[model samples]
Target: MSETTNVMNSEVVKRLLCYVSYDTQSKDESSEVPSTQKQFDLAKVLKKELEEIGASDVRLSDHCYVYAKIPSNLDKKVPAIGFIAHMDTSPALSGKDIKPQIIQNYDGGVIKLGESGFSMGPNEFPALAELKGKSLITTDGTTLLGADDKAGVAEIMTMAAFFLAHPEVKHGDICIAFTPDEEVGNGVEYFDVPGFGADFAYTVDGGSVGEIEYENFNAANLRVEVQGYGIHPGSAKGKMKNAIRMAMEFEQMLTVFDNPEYTDGYEGFHHLGGIEGDSDHTTMHYIVRDHDAGKLNQKLAEIDKASEYLNFKYGEGSFKVVRTGSYQNMKEMILPHMHLVEYAKEAMRELGLNAKSVPIRGGTDGARLSFMGLPCPNLCTGGANYHGRFEYACIEQMELCVEILKKIVEKYAVKEI
Candidate 1:
């Protein structure tokens, strides 16, 4: 592990620790709007912080979203800009009782993660080379650090403090929002775009330090059900059908290369999720994604074709498939507003960082917001290895993220600043 830098002592890291201390993981099976009731724990904290920082019109929605505004100090008209980040962590790992360790001056050596006997070395993660001599905020090998989006939340909150403390910075209306349930694919389901009243927005939820995304996968959910006939062993010769085996067979129908492990960079994929069942019935879930809507449609059609073939072999009514549409590629919505992308690039340039506009393999709240007339794009949070135990974030990079956001506000909030 590296040495903990003084940057780790900044308000951004302090706010992040405060936010992650609460267990705010969203459940996939929950029918609630925010997916989990505990998410409001952090929502209330953020609402109080926003109000304390002199943010105007602060509101915490019943759905657990925190919205606030930093009124423009300038007299002229400038476009209202918004910054957003999610509050809930992923349910894949435990987020309760998180103990974040600060490692200062990483020495490119094996860093011990608590007493769990688990360690992080550059041998396993070559990207650690780039973080040499930097401070890192990591978990204790038992749970995630919640830096996926919490890092983003901290950065936005820090920027709000800066704007309030230094009114001489001179910027127009700055809108900030913190949402929940983004990890469960329902982050902005009830987000009121017009009510937020931002001409353009940015989701500070990307991985790595310099990632800026305008394109994302067109996503859809797939569900397959198998029905089987159960009979006594003595008379099971041809009367018995195993639903488990049918589900496994359906999985084999898809191309092996069209999965997350075998594809990257503009390539589409069909990812199979949890499968549960016995001999009487089986339920399987999948997610199909692609950069092109036409290709995404073809993937869904392929699932239908697989179902038809299974029905042919196992008799009709034996197999069933259903799909629900999720968010689409935001590239279509962002192309008309290239200035948003360019403005972010210019902000990074001002900070001596080259922002790369990469395509998101998964969906983001900004992608959904773009289609909803917000024209939002994604920015980096300086987090790496998200949604798992190995996740960690760079504190120096996070501070730089805060600076980049402040620059964006300074650039677009006024023509001459």
Candidate 2:
């Protein structure tokens, strides 16, 4: 890439491309905090960048969390605001050897990902139609682009750079953090929210340009295990009870209409994440989600009812269900601190962007942080179709996200809660 191209490309895009190069795909079921060691690879880089950008008290923790503080330039005391993003990518897809392709002045047509390979058409992804004439960064079909949170990271970094160059811009203290293993549901498992030193924060992990999320799913993981009597087919009369068959029956008992594919927009889901088993033993995995806590509990109870019925039919110890709470809807927590959300909205509006306050269908680190006394909401990073090969980020939109962050800081400097 020449200096001309570098100047032409947005700083957010450049930072995204650089961050995605380091493979930071987190591992599932790993006992470690980050679940993967390579998450620190990006953490160290972010620490160095923060220091270079004039962010003070920067520290890269042993668990791959990078924390920094930007001192206040203002005289009056105001609420210290924070910004956060995750370091690891989704473990469901490969985040290795990412080769990002830039599409400048995008035409409203089918976009080919690689030569003679996977393609993205406006017809298939109507969102692309809205991005016409914008610069997009996409990956080759083989790997994920990791825009999910890296876009968030770049936007915050861009804000740090802006704050460094322009000290005259008054603001209260700014706290920033980069977390790891967010994809594995342990984003802030060991996070020190009190030590982060922010009255409130925003996780720049939302999708699209003007999105602000305070409501998210009350999430939980469900597992069903089925036990079966293994008997030879020829000798099996009424003794052979196939566990896999039983597991299938249990899954069937759940309403298919409430699943991920069928539901959208504040509608809860009983997503069958995965299922694996044999004739002797089988297990069914699910992620139960709902914006309403009561509804989420009802979904879990329904799963238990299914398991109870199966056990009654197959005898005791034949079936078992396990439910583990992941994260809760942050709406209640955010309500008291609505000014934080308003600041983001005002910031976007100041930049001539229409801010959309939408409920996140999925959970973010901010959701958990809000419950943990941080009252953090989510801000967009200008990316769409995250966690897959088709994931892409709008370069111009991300630059706008950087501006939004700066505006938010300025808003806090002037406005009172």
Candidate 3:
């Protein structure tokens, strides 16, 4: 019933729809900063839109990062807060020519997607049960909805528009940015944290409403290579060692219960992402994740132990393990600034939203930015089932998120904490 809620509803939806229409899916294999050139499409649009909305210092970096500022209206200086979101969608699904389906007044039943034969109900997606009577936006089953962070982008843009429209609202310097390739984990690769000019910031790239995240998994990528002797099948008793089978053995050495499908809520996981090879040579790709840094190291040690045992059993140099650190949990960085979390919770509470601090099962740009310098936390964008065809967003929840953001800005404006 609040003025902000009413005003942001349509505008946020319009922005989201416009953003998803651009094919901004980032590629993981590319060496480019954005990983894909299409991300600039959305970046350009955001830059133009930000300038049009009266935001100052609007600049779209060559690397596809859009940065802008809303000058402080108050005479007294307060902490400059930044709001961030990503411009790229995940490469898991095709993001080209997306035709969004807008379901008005969702009735808590099985809603079918457009002609792609995909239907989701309360039974499958339990989150849908609580979303009845709300307006839902979904994909047509042919492509992803791009709501993972586009919803966040739209919410931030809408909030910026609100602040620019109401000068009397009185706020400190508001920093705004939309970075590229967040889906591929290079969102902050070219980000200039010092130049961003924020005492602290938030990445509005979370699921559902009222979810505030500061903790995320300590992540690493693992590659295991196996070399085996190949012989004719006619005489392959003890003379031949199959690399594919050895690779499977290396996988079995990992704890079965520690896999992604079996783990949840702070539990570490070793996910076997893919396997490629033949009898002579095999390669296994895995991602290791845990909330605790020590536990994450333990997981990597376990992989090393498995590799050593396999090498001992087979032959030296038969098993190889390569571990690469991805990103660490942001809890330590944000702990020194717990007020950021409290302010977000307080803002949501004032808007009748029950904010909950949840651990991010995956990483965000904020996770890296936190360690870089800014104590940034993650905020909800009213999205669900990210990076896939079943992705959707709740219109009412998104409007509430915009309001929550507005409230957070207002709090920072009046108080320094």
Candidate 4:
């Protein structure tokens, strides 16, 4: 057996199982740094684990960010590298009381989730076919499996444990951080970039084993409000304008082909995520995304154009649009530092894995951190079908990710600063 395969088969998997048990789902409507206090529960567990593993300077911030470092044992100074992952799971579904089910030696066939009446097969998820004979961790269908990022957390923790256990292994300074509220997009709001003190960083928050991401969507949120004149039906005439009807009209103005269901692979879309309110007033929430900044601006302009036309028809101030910039594509920041990408690919290749550079259709904390001057890219965590109950993580693949991280660390150790 290989040395990588012999390093505690149960360690990474045990850590992952412990992490998903915490209810760390972030809230979007809450106006707080973490957006939810439950994130601190997991943060505290990670902080103690880091200290137990002999990581130096382990600190849990007041805002629920956990930071630590593994000091270099080398005589020469090398570039300090950081690995980051988020603590909070997506609020799209309930994350409370996640009961993860372990399937040993998957048969490359249909598998049923515990009592939740949900089942997955190789036909529906082709990725499962490739993972045959490997142990898989999945949810019970009552709640979402927190593998979206918990798999990442476990991998990093296991890597830290490995390096600390083997004193003979030489490497440079290794920085680690676990941020909160990434699911709600406020992940790096108060992140201490200078304090974390890494020359460059990577977020281990991507799906699949060999995926590497540097490009992401230029994203923005749009809020559309429509004010209508309301009156009793008996007394109502042409003066009574239905706000809900007008809101539907505004939605119809958007191109049908530009919706998420129809677009893929560099295609941009305007997704109407939520809508609320009744006759007198109506509000529609949309997230607009495009890899191209110019195209993103054009989509925003479409919203403005629609609002202007509605206001012209219904009188001034009757229709309004609020656009909020979220995060931009990290491609520009990473292009100047191609070594980060090349080194990651080399590490994966060294592990006999095919490295695939896939653009993130959504965003990660790395997307915002790159613009914040860290030039962060993203790495895979061996999980798939994120943000839903169908999520699962492969044990063997996650262990390989740990090996990949260790190889990258070795590469940077020899690299000239």
lDDT string for model 2 (1-417, tens) is 112375356677778989999999999888898899999899999999998888999998888899999999988899999999999999878999998888877887888887628989789899999999877888887889999899999899989888888898888999999999999889999998887999999999988888899999998897778999988999989789999899889889999898899999999999888889889999888999999999999999999899889899999999988775578899999999899888889889888999889999989899888888899999999998888989998888898999999999988899887
Error of 1 at 59 (Å): 0.7
Q: Return the TM-score for candidate 2, rounded to 2 decimals.
A: 0.97
Superposed on all Cα atoms, model 2 deviates from the true structure by an RMSD in Å of: 1.5
Two-way TM-score contest, 3 vs 4, winner: 4
Would you list the C-alpha lDDT of every candidate in the order shown? 0.90, 0.89, 0.91, 0.91
Candidate 2 ranges with C-alpha deviation above 4 Å:
1-9
Cα lDDT tens digits, model 4, 1-417, are 112333335788889989999999999877898899989999999999999989999999999999999999999988899999999999999999998888887889988888989999889999999999888888888889999899999999999999999989989999999999999889999999999989899999998888899999999988898998888878888778888999999999988889999999999999999999887899999999999999999988988898899899889988889875578999999999989999999999988899989999999899899999998999999999989988999888998999988999999999874
Candidate 1 TM-score over all chains jointly: 0.97
Ranking under TM-score, best-scoring first?
Answer: 2, 1, 4, 3
Question: Each model's TM-score?
Answer: 0.97, 0.97, 0.96, 0.97
Question: Which residue runs does candidate 4 get wrong by more than 4 Å?
Answer: 1-9
lDDT of 2 at 98: 93
Instruction: Please give the RMSD to the true structure for each candidate, in Å.
Output: 1.6, 1.5, 2.8, 2.7
What CA RMSD would candidate 4 show? 2.7
List model 3 lDDT by residue over 69-138, tens digit each: 9999998989999999998989899999999988887889998888988888889899999999888889
Clashing pairs in 3: none
By lDDT: ranked, best first? 3, 4, 1, 2
lDDT string, candidate 1, 14-93, tens digits: 99999999999999967788899999999999999999989999999999989999999988998889999999999999
